[model samples]
Target chain A: MIVSIEKCHHCGACVGSCPKNAIFLNDLVLVFSDECNRCGRCVKLCPVGAITMEAKK
Target chain B: MRKIEKDIVVVGAGPAGSMTAKHAAKKGARVLMIEKRQEIGSPVRCAEGISKHWVEEVGITVNNKWVAREVRGAKIKSPSGHTFLVDEKNAGNEVGWVVDRVLFDKALAADAARAGTEIMVKTSATSLIWENGKIAGVRAQTYGEPIEIRAKCVVGADGYESQVGRWAGIDTSLKADDIDTCYQYRLTGIDYDPDYCEFTLGSAAPGGYVWIFPKDEDTANVGIGVQLSKVKHPADPKMYLDKFIAKRPGLKKGQPLEAVAGAVSICAPLDSVSMDNLVLVGDAARMIDPITGGGISIGCIAGMCAGKVLAKGVKANDLSMNTLQEYETMWRDRLENKQWRNWMAKEKLTTLSDETLDKIVHTFSQYGVEKLSVQDLLAVIKRHHPELVKEFEELI
Candidate 1:
């Protein structure tokens, strides 16, 4: 998952919505760690449409 | 590689930051306000309703340009459809206008710039600058370029995810119950009372409420805020909102124009909002109304207080905790009691069953009580529903 820094208002709606708790905010940056299962819960919960699932690298 | 200096640096050019910069610059303090987004207010996240009283109090004139609609009152509906309507004049600060948030935010930032405050957009503050264990400034990315801004005083107005507060060691984390996951749709072609804002309570929005704030004769911001802690199963506020719209015939007729989602902090103000040369304002300080989730007016009020205190501190060459504490004291004096009361009301409100909510609405309607206060609510319960008085006695 990728969070567009420009679109994110840093509300952290995605942080709490992540069931795996893989999403965390560090200094206003939304970081999705290795634990993320791509459930895409954060994407639907994000109010600003800042989060998107990127093809796995 | 660029380094800039100012007397005060304000992060986030939302209402709070602009107001803070405006006041500080008006007081002759050199202020720089920055916004991470390219525009001052884009991808609007608010319900956009603000009281006319505070708008005037903050010295901003309410004109037609940004005032989308002026509501005569608010309507509260229970799950069973029992309704109570409060007149605007009697509703105190909760009743007023639904604004164009983008224009309103731009106007505030313009005011700050007019007051000689330097403004920057597309600048993201990634970290705080600490000098000798005292807060000094921010390290930021401006237009994808690294830059450092050092200031005598720093104001963190960075909305709900306030990293500045966390970096400054002010615990900004919220309990699950203290937050609302919200989703809103700006719907046009809707049939709604243009003169009234409407709220629906009960299972439609568990632990929170659904609101229809009319923006025009045929358009409204239809939104729902669900308490994160109260959500079960899927735990998605959007799903709840979809269900709400699907059930309402009037809403079902409306065409969605834009969608917005965000989180709101519905907690009491932080225990402490200031440290050495650092202060937190707006949503960063959790200035949102616990029940209503309205923060524009409160955020502006707090911003003004911060600006005044920051200016004083800058003039005295004392940006220490002692001086910045005045901002905290001023905000608490102005808003703390009301915030705490609302938080208590929210705590109790979340526990009520839909049946009880229907009964409460029915009771209020029977007693001709539309606007609710702790005292008024207790009085009504004591008179008509005495059995519940013990449960709510603590509110009195």
Candidate 2:
């Protein structure tokens, strides 16, 4: 998952909604860690559409 | 790395943190409040609406700088557009102020500072500092520099995304059904009644509702909350709110000035909020009203209770869970029953069909129910539509 710095409001919706507890908002930066299973709970719950799925290289 | 010592250390610096610090400091416990953000309140996330009664209860004077508009009443509409007005004079604290949350947060933090609490900005708590396998303080950082704060009491006043409680071995988990994913826009150039806050309920926002809180006659905070369980698409909350606004004649033409989003916990009150030297308050404690999804007033009240209890425990030199249990009992005695009642009602209400909502609202408009609340609605239903009362009685 990718968090868009420009669009994200940093409100913690995605951080709280992630079932795996894998998301964290470090000040202005929204961090998605490897603990995220791509269940996409954060994607649906993200208020600003800041998070999107990316092909894991 | 720097080391600091205080009688109390509060994390988050929001209303709950500041209130705890303010009251604890006032009672002579040294207090320090830390915020990860450089500014106390910005990039506003709340709907920014609150009842005024808690201000006086929390001993905060009404300050115009933070009050955007003093609403006189609330106008509720069902899916079919049937409207019911609940006037403040008659409804008591049902409707009050549409505030500037940024200014309000700053004011609370300032109040804490004035009460002799030390406040640090750009600091974040990384973990709990443990001693003898029990909580002692916080492992934190200022900007990028690590620091350890050793305190007798630690407060988890962090909001929805809080980790402080989890770090303390407190369970703060939520089911998807218990969370509300919200999106809002501060829209200007709309014709709005500055005196009345408005709400639209039913399938427009499944398992939740849309609200319009006027900042002024020409501007308003228009928002929608969709139950996380009901969201089936990416960005469903924003989509739902946009579609709702696009259909309203006056709202459709409004231009966006700001955007806000956050998750509101609409679950039952936690089983406990205190453990040993640690206690959680505000959203961390799940002090929000499940039906309204409003937290400011209730959270402030919880903060006041927390502040009093923690300070007393500190002064007694016993930070054990038994001592902290006083806080648990006090807050639960005052807030738990109501929170549970509302949670139960919300469960039943969310399962209701759009036609049921239209009918219920239509009846409310016709019968002229003096106030609108879960208890009041149930009472009215018992008096008039006795048969329908059973649908709600099963839970309450």
Q: Which ten residues in a row have the lowest lDDT in candidate 2 chain B?
A: B387-396
- Measured over the true interface residues after superposition, the C-alpha RMSD of each candidate is 4.9, 1.2
Model 1 chain B poorest 10 in a row by lDDT: B228-237
Candidate 1 lDDT, tens digit per residue, B263-333?
89898767998888888999888899998999999999999999888888889999897788888889999
In model 2, the runs with Cα more than 4 Å from the true position are A54-57
Clashing pairs in 1: A47-B261
Off by over 4 Å in 1: A1-12, A15-30, A33-57, B370-372
Candidate number of the best DockQ? 2
Model 1 captures what fraction of native contacts? 0.22
TM-score of each: 0.91, 0.96
lDDT of 1 by residue, A1-57 (tens): 777888776656776445565777765788888989997666655654577889888
